[model samples]
Target chain A: MNAYPSKLVERAVEQLSTLPGIGRKTALRLALHLLSRPKLDTHTFAHALTEMRDGIIYCRQCHNISDTELCSICASPSRDTSTICVVQHVGDVLAIENTGQYRGVYHVLGGVISPIDGIGPEELLIDELIERVRSGTVKEVILALGTTMEGDTTNFFLYRRLQDFSIKVSVIARGIAIGDEIEYTDEVTLGRSILTRTDFDQSIRF
Target chain B: MNAYPSKLVERAVEQLSTLPGIGRKTALRLALHLLSRPKLDTHTFAHALTEMRDGIIYCRQCHNISDTELCSICASPSRDTSTICVVQHVGDVLAIENTGQYRGVYHVLGGVISPIDGIGPEELLIDELIERVRSGTVKEVILALGTTMEGDTTNFFLYRRLQDFSIKVSVIARGIAIGDEIEYTDEVTLGRSILTRTDFDQSIRF
Candidate 1:
């Protein structure tokens, strides 16, 4: 039989190895590290993980994670409520926020449409988003999902749903990213960059 | 102010990032992955970590992790208790066990002697080990610690202490590993391999 110093240590390693990107060796190291620390520190770590999982609430309006009913972005009066930036996950929301380029609230779809994964439109917050747009307060819906096939499928689906609302629907621009060398850029991105080249004045503003 | 969608998420990410090799980005991904799983899975994970920390016991004889007063190795009657393999941590014991090369028991020092880290002989299980050797049943003590300065210091200290007990002391062999080519091998290891070259028959047995 395989030997572990203790069943408790083995159980902790097993649980930690279940995390993404962590293997058994890494899990053993992390488990030992936790064991070496002050007992109070490990207690705090466990408490934080459990409490975050159990108590975190999703924003009612936009389905973003929030401590309260409305997320900070949705609660702020300064953000443009008329424009909603649509994203696939909370991480994307943070990435967009880091850019400091947009001052609009966001609607998180939880995930994009992936039929192979059995994730359909009904599994997402599409109905809530449609209702928000129908309320007449929203004037524009910006699609900022990924560029994968699933992302494209989700964008097309959302566009079809919002067609009769008389609200403007737009997609985030995609091409060679800023500071990327043109020679090293992927063929599809370089072709799209030329086909959808922005005016000189607009490019200079960015 | 630094922005996080929720204070709970920020706290979880902070706690997770405290683990070795887990950066903020990876911690955030892990936290989100846990949140996406069933609430029961996360609860189980947290419970395992906390329970392991608060309830795990250390074997009185060898200071290895244990569910009882004596670790399984220490309690077993079939194992060769007369030959103790001393290591720096519980993980080291597991690693050696996985090799299936040794049948002797283990003594975990918890850490090596390092003046830079303020860890001295008193901080480790050196005194307990000396007492174990003084019991006279132990015939040999193998030092299986790392090759670092701290490991050497600790090994020297233990060797000096065991001198008075009449127990045979040995260290695990150190040289270029079997799979490593001489061209890519480091200078110190190559020199050591030549200086401590084993007899052909002895090497063939391994």
Candidate 2:
């Protein structure tokens, strides 16, 4: 690697490269871009990140990121308190919210159970979810996690834990996407779609 | 766009997405990734950017980013001060440095002369470069700008400005890259390589 002319530039690049997808070249580009802009703009950008990191809170009820004790969905009276969508991360909560179809609040697990990665139920918010369900307020728990091995393990684990509770548990449907061609769909997904096909009316409603 | 659950999250995504290649989706990803890590890590990252923006200086001699009045390269006596490589940005200086080929100091022009972008000689460090050359310390000025129209325009403009000074003005060579096949080479580059074929001895040295 070429030594950066300025230590400040070097530090900025190093810090930025730590982000999930950003590499050294991209980090350098981002640093230089911030340098090229007005000082106030960069200050604002930095301030936003700092504020988010230091001030943002997780909802007490759902573990979703929020500016208050409860996330917007959990705080709002219109949202269904009886139903909860359990997800692996805050990003998944955001993704489900973007759909605008689900009226329920979310429970962010923080991470799924991954044996190789050493992540287990204890590392996630699984205990909090069980407590919330045991309160007798929640009637349904939607498993919105991915189809990966880790996600499946977490789902089964959660299912076993919630079995004693009176609440109904459901997994998000998995199949070919709405507009995806049948020929392009994977064999396993296609086979599963055929076996667990929903009613045409229900599918059209979605 | 779906409204982010938290105002802080929304603001961070807005600020991050303003970067050159980052879109809203990527910005959200980055923001969530930062939130996933320890608060100290994000603070350090934000501090680095803020410090770089507010504390970084431009070299008095070459206009390169620096912590002091003079950049490290410009201050180092071991570097060839008599020969100056002119580039449009600090990234170029880093790129050249990575090659470990160029031993001379650099003159960062800040940007190329671009009429469409309203970037001209006045916006660049051309005046400082001219003053440096007029001091009679430089022997050669290497135009290491890009192969774009703006690059060529800036090169010609610099050449005209340096005509009065008793110094050799040259451009970095352009040709098919080493290990690149002729069949895959662009027509203009192939034509240029043929037109500006170098001596066998010099070519072998490179």
Candidate 3:
């Protein structure tokens, strides 16, 4: 390991390396880059991080990150309140929002059920989701989660919880992507795409 | 672009994207990671960057990042102040020091002479280096710089300036690396390695 010439640089690198996916070398590079930049840039970077940590709040209804009690999607009057899309992380909510295909609000479950990691349904917002469904206004619940075992476990748990209610429950469809070639597509996805194939005219705009 | 559920997240992502090598997607990921961590972690990260930028001082003699008036290498009595190694940046100084090979002090030139980048000799610390040489205590000045065209230009410029003095001006040697095979070496480097080969007995100890 290389010893830094400056103690300040060493400290900066140490702190930066704590971030996920960043290692010692990248931390050193980031530290050096910050040193090369102006004081205002450093101040802005620090100020943004601190402000985000101290000020940002989670939505009371869906549990997504928000500036107010309700996230923008949850608070928007035009969004359908009857349909809720349950996802694993706040980033997923942003991803769905970016797609612009879903018009319903989101429920961020924080993470999928991972027993090996000691995470259970109680660790997530599963109970809050149950409460949201019990309110009787929700007509449909969409499971928008990863295809991992943990995601499947969480989805099944949520299914059991909401099965008592008289509402529709659906999981997002799985298929080969639009631009993917069938020859190169994975066998499971190709088989599932064939099994779930819609009518010829329904699959395309005539 | 995805619309962040929170304005704070949007602002945080915007600030993080300004960092070198970080794109909007990576910035968003970083911001979300910060949000997932404790407030203390965020505080520590922010404090380190701001403090490093605000507190780090440049060595008066070597122009390297330092906590004191002189860098640790320049301040140490054991290091040979008479023989100075000149390099491009503080990072280079750290890199050379890590090797534990050199016993001399350093003079950082900040950057190479790049006319395309609008960085000339005046933009660098060339004049300060000459002043140090003129002090008459320097016996040798090693030009430890990169092998690029800009590095060569700067090396030539520095040599011309130091030729009037009685001090020895030399460049660091370039050759195939220790673990590298001669067959894989580039033609220019292979030919130069042959040209600069030392006596067989002197090159290796028995």
**Per-model TM against the reference:** 0.96, 0.94, 0.92
- Lowest lDDT 10-residue stretch of candidate 1 chain A: A1-10
Model 2 lDDT per residue over B128-193, tens place:
999999897899999999999999999999999999999999999999998999999999999999
- DockQ for each numbered candidate: 0.71, 0.80, 0.78
Candidate 3 wrong stretches, greater than 4 Å: A181-201, B181-199
Model 1 residue B82 lDDT?
Answer: 96
Q: Name the candidate, 2 or 3, with the larger TM-score value.
A: 2
Report the C-alpha displacement of residue A16, candidate 2, in angstroms: 0.6
The runs of at least 3 residues in candidate 1 whose Cα sits more than 4 Å from the true structure, single-residue gaps closed, are none
Each candidate's fnat = 0.82, 0.90, 0.89
The global C-alpha lDDT for each of the candidates, from Candidate 1 onward, is 0.92, 0.92, 0.91
lDDT, candidate 1, B12-120, per-residue tens:
9999999999999899999999988998999999999999999899999988889999989899988899999999998888899899989998899989999998998
Q: What is candidate 1's DockQ?
A: 0.71
Residue pairs whose backbone atoms clash in candidate 3: none
In candidate 1 the C-alpha lDDT for residue A63 amounts to: 88
True contacts kept of 3: 0.89
First chain of model 3: TM-score? 0.94
**Quick one: ranking by TM-score, best first?**
1, 2, 3
Compared with the true structure, what per-residue lDDT tens digits does model 3 show for residues B1-206?
A: 66777778889999988877889999999999999999999999999999999999999999999988988888898999999999998778878988898999999999999999999999999999999999879999999989999999999999999999998999998889889999999999999889998788987873
Worst 10 residues of 3 chain B by lDDT: B197-206
